[model samples]
Target: MRHRYGFTDEACAFFDFFAAPAPELADRTLTALQHALDTATLDHPRALRYGRLLQAYELMFWEGLREG
Candidate 1:
C-alpha cells in the first residue's frame, strides 16, 4: 500500500496563515476545511476540494486543480 502526508503544501500554507508555523498542530478537519475550500484557487470549488481530499495518494489530485 502507499501513503502520503496528511497535509499538502497549500494546506501547510493555509495553516501558516493562522498558526504562523504550527501546521502540524493545525486541525485538518472541518476546522480548516472552509478556509481550504476558499483558498483552493480553483475554477471549480467542488472539484478542487474533492481533489484535496485525495491529494496525498495522488498529488496531481489537487496540485493545480484550483485557480488563483
Candidate 2:
C-alpha cells in the first residue's frame, strides 16, 4: 500500500532548502541541526517549531542519501 502526506508551503520550503546541499554534507547538516535543537529553549514557540522541522528534515535527508 502507498501513503500520502500533505505539507504546508513553509514545510516544503524547509525541505527544499536542506535538500539542495550535497549528500556528503548530510552528516554536517544533521550535526548542526542537533546543536540548534539542543540549544533552543522551550519558552520560545517559534524556535521549538523550527527545531522540530529541522529534525524532520534531518531524517528525510539521511533516508534520501541511503536510498540514492
Candidate 3:
C-alpha cells in the first residue's frame, strides 16, 4: 500500500520493516533512521529535509495509533 505522506523507498522500507512485530526490529529501525539523519549530506539538502520529514511522519503515525 502507498503511504499518504509519499511513497518513497525509505517510507516503503519503514512500513515493510514494521509490518511484523519484533522488539529487535524496532531497535534496528531506530538505529537505521538515526544513522541516515546523522549522515545526510549538506551537498544533498533534500536528503536531510526528506529524512526529517519522514521522521516526523513516523512519530506522528505511531502517536496517533497509540491514541486511537
Candidate 4:
C-alpha cells in the first residue's frame, strides 16, 4: 500500500522511540535535542530556532505516520 505521505528510515527510527517500556531512545532524543538547541542558540544566535526546527520535524513526522 502506498501512503499519501511517507516516512523515511531516520524518522521511523525516531518515532519508534516511545515504543519501548524503557527510556533509552527517549533519553537519547532529549539529550540530542537539548544539545542541538543550545548549539543553535550559541552558534546561530537565534533563540529557539533549532528547537522550533525540531518541533516542525516532529510535527511532520506525525503527519506522515498518520497519513497511511
TM-score of 4: 0.38
Model 3 clashing residue pairs (backbone): none
lDDT comparing candidate 3 with the true structure: 0.75
All candidates' lDDT scores? 0.56, 0.70, 0.75, 0.66
lDDT of 2 by residue, 1-68 (tens): 01235666665675566657667688996786688679873345776788799989989877996797
Q: Please list the residue runs of candidate 4 whose C-alpha ends up more than 4 Å from where it truly belongs after superposition.
A: 1-15, 19-47
Candidate with top lDDT is 3
Clashing pairs in 1: 41-66, 41-67, 42-66, 42-67
Any idea what lDDT model 1 has?
A: 0.56
- Supply the TM-score for candidate 1: 0.20
Name the Cα RMSD for model 2: 11.7
lDDT string for model 1 (1-68, tens) is 01255776666774346434445645665556667568974456676777677656545534554332
Give the TM-scores of the predictions, in the order they appear. Answer: 0.20, 0.35, 0.39, 0.38
Two-way TM-score contest, 2 vs 4, winner: 4
Which residue segments of model 1 deviate by more than 4 Å?
1-43, 56-68
Ranking of all candidate structures by their TM-score, best first: 3, 4, 2, 1
Q: For candidate 3, give the lDDT of residue 46.
A: 75
Q: Residue 62's C-alpha lDDT in candidate 2?
A: 78
Tens digits of per-residue lDDT for model 3, 25-50: 78996787688668873344776788
